[model samples]
Target: MELEGKVVVITGGSSGIGLATARMLLEKGATVVSWSRSRPKISHPDFYFFECDVRHEHSVWAAYEQTEERLRQNISVLINNAGLGIQGALDTMSPKDWLTMMDTNVNGIFYCTRLVLPGMKRMREGHIINVSSIAGIMGSENLTGYCASKFAVRGLSEALYKEVRDYGVKVTCLYPGSTDTGFFDNFEGVTSRENMMQPQDIAATIVHALQSPPNFHHVNIEVRPLMPKGPKSPKKA
Candidate 1:
């Protein structure tokens, strides 16, 4: 669909990928509404900011409702980017932390998607982009809970893609690896921010997916850094 003047809703828009996406979408002539628990200072005239906690169903509903009323348009695109990361060995991680991961990453997507489905079906045209992670595709040693949550997110995206394809809605899932975002602060291991992907890069990919032709529905895209080759053995001795 043409992005010009289209209304797009993005969750977790205070920072990271969502923020970057909001800016990019604005550049593409889309009217963008961004939701977060804390509102960030965005300077764009076309960008509307909404404070919302996606983990709470009411918060998600209110944000969308307000956006719809103000914009006078059902959302043409919904980007599910609200996520949390809790890192530790599964045995060492607290039950609360595990539940937090599931609530924010899994249940949050479920709530937002459920609210948007009706409008999308009625219009017979919409896009849903769920931000997953490389950990969703490959397991990590200390990030068991996070991995599980992201894996569930990817699964949900796939299921929704199948269910919504018949309704003229496109569902795209993204698996970005170790992005240089707040997510790294939760990890206990060494983190080189420079080595990881940037939020802007992932946001660009999301926009590309949004612009993709209807005949080419890229349901899933896995993004990762180039793997380092092993050290040469002393030049073959």
Candidate 2:
């Protein structure tokens, strides 16, 4: 599909992967719409930002309506990139924190995808990318809630593609490795932030996927840096 003048909506466009992807897409000549609770520090003629909290269905729906109304165009692509992570044992986790993680990581995707699917199906041409985590593939200690949410995303993406493929819509579930995007801010002492993948790395992969042939259906792609830094790393390396 041509990226030129394509309408792409990205959640959490204020920072990290979403921000990087938004900038990259804009560079590719795609009109970018940012749906984020926090405003982004981006300035471009083709770039627009809308304040949205994806956790609430109404908030997502309203933002979608307003964005399309303003652009006067149907979304050609959707990136459910807004995600939150809380690391704790279930018994030690607070209800508020857990809910925040679940709502942001899982429910947000549901709401955003739901709002855009009918339009995408009607158009019979669209792409949806759901950002999961490596934890979604492998469980980790003291990170059960975060893992569960990412795993749910994997499941959703797997089922989503089968449901939408015949309609010419593509669904991709991305499992990205630890990136130094303040995603580690919630964890006290885990890994060296400088040793992880960069947001631009993930952003580049997303752009490459978008540049694929129209018939190409990317079901799931896992990206990890070589010699990934773990919770306990030797100082020498």
Q: Which candidate is the best by TM-score?
A: 2
lDDT of 1: 0.87
How many clashes show up per model? 0, 0
For model 1, how does the per-residue alpha-carbon lDDT over 1-237 read when each residue is reduced to its tens digit?
Answer: 789999998999989888889888999999999878988668877889888998888988898888888888888899999998877898899999999889899999998989888999999899999998988898989889999999998899989899989989999999997678887775576545677778899989999999988767989999876632323466653
Candidate 2 residue lDDT tens string, 93-161: 998988898999999999999888998899999999999999999999889899999999999999999
Q: Can you list the residue pairs that collide in candidate 1?
A: none
On lDDT, the candidate that comes out on top is: 2
- Per-candidate TM-score against the hidden true structure: 0.93, 0.95
Off by over 4 Å in 1: 227-237
Q: Cα deviation in Å at residue 123, candidate 1? A: 1.4
| Residue 7 error, candidate 1, Å | 0.9
